[model samples]
Target: MRASLTPTDAPLRARLLALALAVAVLAAVAVVATVRAADRAAEKDRAQPGEPAAHAGEVTLRQPGRLLFRNLAWGPQRDRVSAVPLTATSGPRTSAPRDCLRFHAAAGTGVCLRATGGVVPGHEAVLLDARLRPVRAFPVPGTPTRARVSPSGRLVAWTVFVSGDSYAGGAFSTRTAVYDTRGGTLHSDLERFAVLKDGRRHRAADHNFWGVTFAADDSRFYATLATGGRTYLVAGDLASRTMRTLRENVECPSLSPDGTRVAFKKRVAGASADAPWRLHVLDLRTGRESALAERRSVDDQALWLDDRTLLYALPGDFGADLWSTPTAGGGAPRMAVRSAASPAVTG
Candidate 1:
């Protein structure tokens, strides 16, 4: 026989039980909501475009305009180059056929050509007009490696490799030549430039030249020499007939349109061979240097859109693409062009 409970006590016990059950349900709902919110945040982060990630170097904006690019495709058996245009709003304009190797533009007109077929064993260079039409094709008495036009479109400079064999291991040498478009003659003789070597063995018979560019005034030009662990930037004065070392251990020197500065890529100290190179800007007047944003992989084929912006090729998983950054500094890179390489800009 149990004693009868008071009605007030009984109601109080019932209320406490109900409150505990409600609290447990509320806690469970809160935990689920918190987890869902966290997942949404992570998804948003990955979905955002132009999110800054580890980069190889700083990007600089040299000019504000559309960028026109020339892409080169090389496989185990074949090689070709093409011309394509890109703007901020539209991705890629139109791509020419794969055979086009070199190009130049003026007043909304451009020209390019298929750099095969006409190359001679000792000489290789083919000139084109503004409509992708082949103008004059000739050999430079050596294996032509690089060719570029003056800013005024009146002059052209090129480097050729004089070698005993066809492939990379062969003994090689270089010759520099300049041609006048208006005069219809070669300005400079096929001058012997440099001799390259493999390893400690000076393949006295081998030489290689690359990365050629003209000065702002087109009175002078520059190129690079690679021999084993040593690299050099050679500035040649056409009038003086002399070459000077502008920098050492540097490759791919790109001159600004104004000729006030030069941008290049190089290996940093303690950097692994697999580590990507960084972009650097050099003041021609002061000889001062500054590193751009750093990246994890190599950057290549840097070109100035203007003095303030730099457009370069950044390699991706599928292929290489074009990217732009401000020269003044700060801000992640933006995609200026996709599926592109060897970018050049015209104002």
Candidate 2:
């Protein structure tokens, strides 16, 4: 015979029963949520309907009239350096076997920044030849944010965020390196370069530099210098190992092909806290500035598709899609390449 519990003990027993039932219900819901998440993750590995066709093949950065970018499509070829028609980016593409987080190429030379996996994850920068074959690899201390090569393809530069992987909390530190492919000279940290802020010697422990854009001369370059809550467009000399501040609020400066202006991200007033940058161009000779027609906040470095058109990446359905806008600031922004990032024009 089952024994009947006392009044107080019966009430405690009821509470215990209710607690167990609630726990079981919560566990069931959690299991369903986890299963749904796993299914969604699995779906990303399969090619969805209406997606662009991509195949693993030889990708050469030496091919002119091709646009090279980090593929963000969902499939086996995802995250590889892919090549597509410069004008018709919506068409099919050829993906290379090499994977990179950021990539840039010029004059048949490519710099691929990739993540390394082990017990401890890390990153590295790989120099690639015209055939997209790695020539050498350099260990990077942190997450790669930018990679660039000189027009002559003799110099390669990269930037890594040292403190954290992103600018999520408005505080981060970066390390920029420049490698001379021809001379085998490497300046692993640009902070060691002498600073000439305001035409006088400037010394600060808080200084940081990134987003290097080389001049056609290959001896001169421009990059962003940050210190004391302000950012500057600093012109640098590789021969002299010095940098001089030019203007303010310029970040990720990409020099124009003509060497007359720079396309950069400017933090403007009346912008949302999270999305705080607008694409702008600064005339290197005249110091005149003009904002582009891209009203959306662009976080990536702007690349000059030509003298008048600018290309950049924005958040998209797959990962990021490249968009184009007129540099003179008139028409609406147009999507240039879908599911691609880190655009580099091959020549």
Candidate 3:
């Protein structure tokens, strides 16, 4: 019952229908392409193993100094420092191992504690220049555990585990030492420093000092002093060669960037043997402590992300992953990076 169309009208209608279908096909392809691109981006965010996400272009240090830490995947005997660019979040660059067991860097200088294996079994500290080249090396004692350089890169410190001071089935005793890079001097052990507890000297041979964190002045420091089956946080004066206890149950203290607070690991009694420590922050001026949101046992010293955030390593099956939390406390912990340990960021 429809009227017949003219020949020209029929041909024009056919062409219009073809054009509409082509446009629909192109639209569908675009949608599919967008979805695939999003999938690739998500995958890149989670870097795999030693591979960091590829950068878009040349990466440079926007903050002038890069982060430096120990690469746990490098193995104990062959561990090296992982230099992470401040401007670039991914794709860290690796430097020579140089027999470093643990390392930390600040300012323009770096410090590496190397462990020697053989019949003697000793440890040593190696100093590095701004270019990460070894400038000087010296022998140290005990098993290497921690190393730190001052903010100015003029002072260095280390902690070593030695036997004969640990309780039965207890953690080994620690020996902490500091060196003056400019003066060519070394304070072999801090245990000899006068220990004052509650305004009185604590005379005990079991006294062990470890995990030394330096102040900006380089002449003042803080460390964990463990004695009499208890641990205390002690503020030390380098020139006076004395340590005064600040508080109890605090260990592995790391000062915040602004020097207002100290992020530390608190040993909690009655917790599981596997996870007995909790992360806490202490206000240096007020002596107030704020418990972080992280409740799991954190053993490593925390690295401050800024004046308000902290970075730490939580032990995992394949090394440890980097995590961050707010310095004010009561915020859920978030993963900042993966497969890293002993984090040190340059100022």
Candidate 4:
């Protein structure tokens, strides 16, 4: 036996139901808002013009145990990213795009800085597999100049010449970006980092960075920071988002396998960009800079063949030839590979 609801009770029950409906609607709207915000953020991070959007969520890279080397000289006629056996005298070229101006390979992964050189120019950073297939592509702002992948293939960094006038004594500006392959995060233009000059905040609009070389731990990196008409070698902390100037006039720094020294191009007092840059090795712990014996102006970021030797590229009639010298200083430069501008050593 249940008593029927009074008229007042009916009104109260109806009001309660309406209140629940309103609360449900608000909750649904909030969920939708959250999802939309996430989508917008991902869209903002992605670069355009590649077949697949640069941000495709997390994709695991398959790496080989023994990775090969790829320089401009090694790739196939169509594609300049062909993997060449380091020990082989010669190898078959692949059909990958030879448009890669600079490239680096490590940990079964690689990155190629491709350029369409013409009256109307365009650039891209193309991620590649060990077989030299494009895994993903991201549009770059300027002429591709440098590319490097961390030893573990967890990070990739690149630089491009963004702006310059021929009348300005060939002076140029660069933009660099570091991408975390695993995290799917890209830090564009390292100039955003809090820069410290002599342990003080340094601010400038013309700050530029290039030639990033990552440490084995992948937490610390070194690169060239140009600002105020001067260039410096900056040691950067990726986690802290900060950089400290280490030395002056150090450009295109490449870390040694031992991580104790860096091979970099030093600007000579009387020399111009047209001539060879004197290459030097700086002991990170000792602050000792030793000049390499290679007299040829080395324009490319030097690569370490082993702890004992260093490799760099010199402009040649054929194109650019890869040359090697001793890291201990005072060794004649020898041709390691011909027609190659960029060299990457795989661990």
| Candidate topping lDDT | 2
lDDT of all predictions = 0.55, 0.91, 0.76, 0.75
What's the lDDT for residue 225 in model 2? 93
Evaluated against the true structure, the overall lDDT of model 2 is: 0.91
Decreasing TM-score order of the candidates:
2, 3, 4, 1
Candidate 4 achieves a global lDDT of 0.75
Best by TM-score: 2
Who is ahead in lDDT, 3 or 4?
3
List model 1 lDDT by residue over 177-252, tens digit each: 6766767767544335332222222342233456566776656877666555456666766556555666776666
lDDT tens digits by residue: candidate 2, 185-272:
9999999999997789999998989899999988999999999988999999999999999998999999999999999999889988
Q: Which digits, one per residue and each the tens of the lDDT, describe model 4 over residues 1-347?
A: 99999989998999999999999999999999999998866654443332111111112124222212333332124224444445642443222443477788777678888865589878899888765678888889988778888878888999988887221133788889999888888998898899999999999988989889999998899999888777899999999999999999898899998899999998787776567379899999999999989976777788887899987877754466678899999868887765555666555
Taking every candidate in turn, the Cα RMSD to the unseen true structure, in Å, is 20.0, 4.7, 19.2, 16.4
**Per-candidate TM vs. native?**
0.61, 0.88, 0.77, 0.75
The model with the greater TM-score, 1 or 4, is 4
Worst 10 residues of 4 by lDDT: 51-60
Query: Model 3, 1-347: lDDT tens per residue?
Result: 99889989988999999999999999999999999998766654454555432222222112365665555443332245665675654565554434367777777677778876799877788888766678888787677777888878889998877764322225677778899988988898998889888999879978888888889998998888888777788999989999999999888899877777889998777887666788999998998999999988887778887888888888754477778899898779987655566767866
Instruction: Pick out the ten consecutive residues of candidate 3 with the lowest summed lDDT.
Output: 53-62
Q: Please give the TM-score that candidate 2 achieves against the real structure.
A: 0.88
Model 1 segments beyond 4 Å from truth?
A: 1-66, 71-86, 101-124, 140-147, 158-177, 185-207, 274-276, 294-299
